[model samples]
Target: MTRNLILGALLSSLVLLLAAVSFIWTPFDHAAMNIPAKLQTPSAQHWLGTDHFGRDLMSMIMVGARTSIAVALVAVGIGMGAGVPLGLAAAARKGSWLDELIMRGNDLVFAFPSLVIAILITAVLGAGAVNAIIAIGIFNIPVFARITRGAALSLWEREFILAARVAGKGAARISAEHILPNVMNLLIVQGTIQFSLGILAEAGLSYVGLGAQPPTPSWGRMLAD
Candidate 1:
């Protein structure tokens, strides 16, 4: 593996381990406050010291990692679950009104950024992690749909796809069996990119006060403070 990949793996593993451990234990209760200790410098008693609220920074950070991970993970899942099938259908029906409709819908969604979408949803739902996830997920659907459709289109004309059609396999079957497998590598790469973007999106929402609420520490909120 490349050096960058190795370093990334190690760092990711460390973060995952820290988040997991946080569920069972932390240096101190993340929400517990000791106002007198606020802004104390890092020391043996508090490796990362204290925040302005006097909460343990390290504990807050540990819990925050999981919160970010959970939001990003679920948002990406929502995107892939909804987007992949829509893309496949559009690709299979290429040139049909169905294809036109799906693509046009994607275009409509693409017009709005995730932040804009978040603001709209949060306006109705009130700001929270769930609303942020929904916003990010909606934005992601068009992205994954576009990627899947484009990749699937190239494979549609391949000899194997043509042969599958001749063998009485339907569009859905061919897409699931043939097209999806061929495009999976591309999707995996795209998913990784999306996952990172999801984290950033979550952070942005939190920073703007549209994400996880107080008592549920967020990296973005920490930065804001």
Candidate 2:
């Protein structure tokens, strides 16, 4: 299990690094068209075959990496940034009206399928990469919040929490110092899961013409074409 986890993490890291590098430099101009070379099979000149439009498939795939990673990172960041805090607050104030409100909001958001929500947001905000990110990010909020809240509730009853309270440490301080550290491992695991979902979501949005705009090179749009 450990070795497998290490291998998976290394592979994911390598992919992310390659994606980042592709943003700065790819083997060829992804948008450049060569009608004569259209649909050419992979060769020395093109590591991957040319597409129907004669764009280098390798380059386009590399460019697509940039879009996928960017959307996933931004979406996950937005979800964690907003959701974690709300979750912590709710956990600290468990059973209060605010806690009830937050959980109910999460449930309401959860009731909508992520794809449907993405479509609605894209329709309202106009189709674009930004809209896709917002949609995915919003969809992820409930997931992160629920995970954090569940983990935090368990930690809140621990001895350290009692000690902190006995020492007169404030709620926010205890949560930040104690609860966050204990739950960070869980968060990291959840973040990785969300990242995978974000990639799928971005691809779906792009396929439907609601994600990256033209010439941006998204895998979803490429598959759609």
Candidate 3:
């Protein structure tokens, strides 16, 4: 399991690094039109050939990586920022009305699929990269909250938690110092999964013309084109 986790982390990191590098340099301008090269097959000059719009495929793919990565990072940030605290609160106050409220709110958010929720949000906010990030991020909040709450609840019953309580550490401090550290591994694993999902979601939204605007390459939009 450790080896597999390390390999997964390495692979994900490499992909993200490549995506970042693509932002500074690509084989060609992704938006550059070459009418003569339109729909051309791969050749010496055009490595990945040209799209119907005469844009370079390799360039488009590279630029799209930037879009995908940006969306995923922002969305994950939103999820962790909002969900972790709520989850910790729920776990610290387990069985109380606050816990019930948090869990129930998570359930309500989870009821809708990410894509459907994205569509609704895009409809209200209008389609753009910022909207896409916000929509995907909101959808991810409940997922992380539930995961964190579950892990923290288990830790709350551990011997160390008892010691912390006896030491006069408040619930919030104990949760931050003890529970969060213990459950961080779980959060890291879940964050990776959500990051991948965010990439796909951003692409899908862009493909449907509800994400990043034109001239800005997006994998989903590229596929759609």
Best by lDDT: 2
Error of 2 at 112 (Å): 1.7
Tens digits of per-residue lDDT for model 1, 65-97 = 999999888988999999999999999999999
- Write out the backbone clash pairs for model 2: none
All candidates: TM-score: 0.95, 0.94, 0.93
Report how far off residue 19 is in candidate 1 (Å). 1.0
lDDT of 2 by residue, 61-116 (tens): 88898899899999999999999998999999999998999999999998889889
**Runs of candidate 2 exceeding 4 Å displacement:** 1-14
Each prediction's Cα lDDT score? Answer: 0.90, 0.92, 0.91
Candidate 3 lDDT score at position 105: 97
Identify the candidate with maximal TM-score: 1
lDDT of 3 by residue, 138-190 (tens): 99898889999999989998998999899999999998898999989999999
Ranking by lDDT: 2, 3, 1
Comparison by TM-score, 1 against 2, better one: 1
